[model samples]
Target: MTKEIWLNLPVKDVEASKAFFTAIGFTPKPDQSAPGERACFQAGKSIIMLFPDATLKQFNGGLGVNDTSTTSQMMISFDAETKEEIDELADKVKKAGGNVFSEPSEVQGWMYGFAFADLDGHRWNGLYMDFSKMK
Candidate 1:
């Protein structure tokens, strides 16, 4: 049973990446390598590590890590407590320089959410589920 998770991502500019996420309510964590080359940000309790291209290249067996600015490798999600929260996050995503590709809306009658992409074009979503609507 895993208790924690960490997502490591590559960024073209660490400072810019940090500012973008922090603008959207994420907090920076102190424990990270290389001040200008790496950063650690927290989304709820999960840790997301941002590393420069040079550092990330050393980790992926020394080759080929595609940039999400062109193609997506994954879409990370966040859990929202209510429908309003989902909508709020969607706004923040755009205001923080991310794109809200899918506006917040009801889905399958029980879930409400929106999809967006970060400055680097990494996709993400914030979803709210109503258990009462489950069959």
Candidate 2:
């Protein structure tokens, strides 16, 4: 069985990606830092592997990169403990040079959430579930 999971993503600039993730509260692992290859960032138990554009191309057998400006392959979601935490994370995302893709809003009157795009144009969703109302 696998003990850990990793999300591999393509990035234009490794340094900038590292900085952006760091500013948004992720810690990069020094061991994964390498030249023209990859950088690993940890978000709680999740590991995000950021690969250079060229390296990622090679890893994908030279497939053309996706147009992240208009489309996304996935949306990484983070669960917040409270609505306040969701708001705070949105602020943090903006402070880290990211843009809020969607404003915080209620979901079916059962949850609150917001979406943001990282410096590399990856979409992330921050959500807070109202468990009290679920009962």
Candidate 3:
């Protein structure tokens, strides 16, 4: 079984990223954060690591940094256990100063969800999956 997971993302400003996530209900994991360069947040059992772009570049080898404004290679999604939870989270995203690209609605019949872009323009989605409706 997979024990744990970590999603690492590059941010222009670590402090701002931390504030954004915190405002949107993500809890900061101080033990996991690396002082000024990295900010860590908890997303369920996963750890979300927000590192300064330059610091992230050092670990990227040659893949290069992602230009989230021009292109999106990743979209972080949060799983919701209830439809209401999805709606609540969607609202929180906007309240935290994030942009909602897709408002809460039925998606593919089985998913009740919404999509938003964080302060760093990182795309994220919150969805409630109805397993019985999936075909």
- Which candidate ranks first by lDDT, i.e. highest? 3
Residue 84 lDDT in candidate 1: 85
Give the Cα-based TM-score of candidate 1 against the true structure: 0.90
Candidate 2, pairs of clashing residues:
none
Clashes of 2: 0
Q: For candidate 3, write residues 1-98 as lDDT tens digits.
A: 88879898989888888888998889999987876789999899998999888888888885678788899988988898899988888888888889
Of the two candidates 1 and 3, the one with more favorable TM-score, higher being better, is 3
Q: lDDT (CA) for every model shown?
A: 0.84, 0.85, 0.89
**Better candidate number, 2 or 3, judged by lDDT:** 3
lDDT of 1 by residue, 32-121 (tens): 645788889888879999988888889988986776767888889888888988887788878888889999998888889999987777
> Top model by TM-score, which number?
3
Could you tell me the lDDT of residue 71 within candidate 1? 83
| TM-scores of the models, in the order given | 0.90, 0.88, 0.92
TM-score of 2: 0.88
The residue pairs in collision within model 1 are none
Write model 2 residue lDDT over 20-113, tens digit each, in one string.
8888778889798885567898876789999987788888899977778988999998788889888888888898899997988898788899
* Cα lDDT, model 3, residue 21: 93
